[model samples]
Target: MTAAPVRLTARALLLDMDGTLVNSDAVVERCFSRWAERNGLDPAEVLAVAHGRQGHATMALLLPDRPAELNLADNERILAEERADTEGVVPVPGAAAFLASLTGLPHALVTSADLPLARIRMTAAGLPMPSVLVTAESVGASKPDPEGFLKGAADLGFAPADCLAFEDSGAGIAAAKAAGVRVVGVGPRALPHHPDAHADTLTTVTVTAAPDGLLTVTVG
Candidate 1:
């Protein structure tokens, strides 16, 4: 028999933003595609590489030969636009309840999105802002590098092995695994490059509703 996906015995959860907790795929794709077109690059290539990476990191990969100042300027422009208009952005199915249930847990938002963009998206989605956010600006590297996830765990006062990660992209999964955290895949199973416990959405996660209004989430 195949072994059950590993679920860590931890008190903290590191949640990813985009596809994991929020359904911002459309907005992200539209924005990035426009950016790519303006830069004379393919939209597909930009989408593929930028899905779970910081904007600056994506710029570095997309325009590796460009000066850092140029990349920064572009990223800043993107952030301003995103923050100003995130109309279609919303939390993933059941994400609001899941996050509400995790009110007392030692969890934090660990996302590749930079601070301003992340906040704008979260606010637009009406999701409670996490106090301990490890944003793109907080890390030297983005997802697929493990730095973001690791930093989140550290900031939460837990080891990576003692944290559970909720991710939706291949890059995010790899980052969580690299950080030694057990992962629960929360979107298209085909997107993840690594093996992990799969769930159709946040609703699929088995959460026990406690009498005191707390939820004990279980990932299988």
Candidate 2:
């Protein structure tokens, strides 16, 4: 017998870009690894603290002795590198279809990547550009701080509790949860974060507009 699907209704959908809506793992790792090598830091350790956080924050963590201005400049250079390298970038499974289904819905992209890098990656993945994009530059802090997600919810004119957040990283999940948003975790990386719902990929979930003006999300 088939098990019943889980359903939730939300006034808006908030999504993380890399590793959630798009797959840019290769480019991300490559750029970060190169940056680490250039800075005499361990690539593995750098990457461990990098994902889902702003570039400047990662740089600050990795090089605490450095001046904040230098970290900011390094972040800008890394963003350019990421923007220039999109060879293996692609949409997450069913991401394109899922986004297409949200035509009339309130949705936004909240990413740690700076604006230019986010644009490059999304364009490479062939994903539709979000009408509302809250990038790293738009917030005072990154994921795990809840600033971006909170800003995203506000930009969509939805209360934090009324939004549904989709994320694939622990930092992102923490951010959403802290902002009082229910989260649908996108992949294995999100497991430890204990999101409200879990899916192997976007393909396993479906969205529909309800009569009561809510977006109904169904997960299998």
Candidate 3:
């Protein structure tokens, strides 16, 4: 039997970039692999824990012995590489239309990417750049800390519980949940996080704004 659809209502929407709204998998993998090869680390292992976390944090995790300045420099190089290579960056399925439907709504883009890289990726994906963007530089701590999502909710002028988050990675899901927001996992990659609602793609979900100013989300 088919499970019944789920509905959630919130005052604001918090979204994650990268694997969530933007499809930059090619650029991400290539850069990480090249960086790993240059650093004498296993590329698979490096990527295994990299997604949904800030580049600097990923560097720190992969090379704990390295000085903080060195990690910072390497992370900058990675961001530069990503910004220069927009070969395959595009929106996730239904992301463009879904975002358009959110016009005039309270929403924010919360991402692990720093400002420049986030802007570049979003532009490449043809997404409408959000006015309120919570980047890596916006928080002292990244995902799994809930700082970014909390900031996003605050920027939207709503409490965490008044927001609904959408994410496509385990770390992003954890961050949203930790911030006290109900979250919809946006892709197969987010399934392991066991988000409140799971959709194979954004196309499987719909958003509607009510006269009462609440956003209604329906997921199949």
Candidate 4:
């Protein structure tokens, strides 16, 4: 016999763009591949730690000796390059309906992409943008720091524990947990991190809002 899905309740939901709601892996890999070649680093190695982080943060980790200014500059260039390319950008399976289900509910987007990059990619994927957002520029630190997730909860006027986060990376899961928010792991990248709930895609998750303003999220 198979076990039942995990059920969680929260006042709001926090969404991660890349890998979670939006499939931007092709653009991410292409841009990172070019950056790696420019830095004389292996593309595969660079990509290993690139997801779930701001470009500068990823660069700082990969090249600890590099100057901060250089990383920041490279991050800007890469963001522009990423925004310019959307060939393979698209919504993750069931992302459209998932967002639709959250309409009129409290939710916020928490992503490592800057607003411009987020806009382009979201538009490319044909996903609607959330009214509340915590972009790369919104936080002083990137994923694994918890700053973004904390701010995302605050932006929605909810305590961290009152909100649930959906994430698709180890760094994102760590950040949400550190912020005291429970999480539902989305997609393959999130499995190893062991979020409070797990689903292969948003297709398996359902949300129902209560009269008292709580949301029950059931995952299968």
* Per-residue lDDT of model 2, residues 52-171, tens digit only: 888888888778889999989988898888888999999999999999999878999999998888888888999998899999889999788999999999999989999999999988
Question: TM-score, each model?
Answer: 0.87, 0.94, 0.96, 0.98
Candidate 3 TM-score over all chains jointly: 0.96
- Reference-based lDDT, residue 211, model 4: 100
Candidate 3 residue-wise lDDT, 52-95, digit = tens: 98888889887888999998898889988988999999899989
Question: Model 4, 50: alpha-carbon shift in Å?
Answer: 0.4
- Residue 49 alpha-carbon offset, candidate 4, angstroms: 0.6
User: Residue 162 of candidate 4: its Cα lDDT?
Assistant: 97
lDDT of model 2 at residue 99? 93
* TM-score head-to-head 3 vs 4, winner: 4
Instruction: For candidate 4, report its TM-score.
Output: 0.98
How would you encode candidate 1's per-residue C-alpha lDDT over 22-62 as one tens digit per residue?
Answer: 78888778878889999999999999878777677788988
Give, for candidate 4, the lowest lDDT window spanning 10 residues: 1-10
**lDDT of candidate model 3 versus the reference:** 0.90
* Candidate 2: worst-modelled 10 consecutive residues by lDDT: 1-10
Write down the RMSD of candidate 4 (Cα, Å): 0.8
Count clashing residue pairs per candidate: 0, 0, 0, 0
Q: For model 2, what is the error of residue 65's alpha carbon versus the real structure, in angstroms, after optimal superposition?
A: 3.3
Candidate 3 has its poorest 10 consecutive residues by lDDT at 198-207
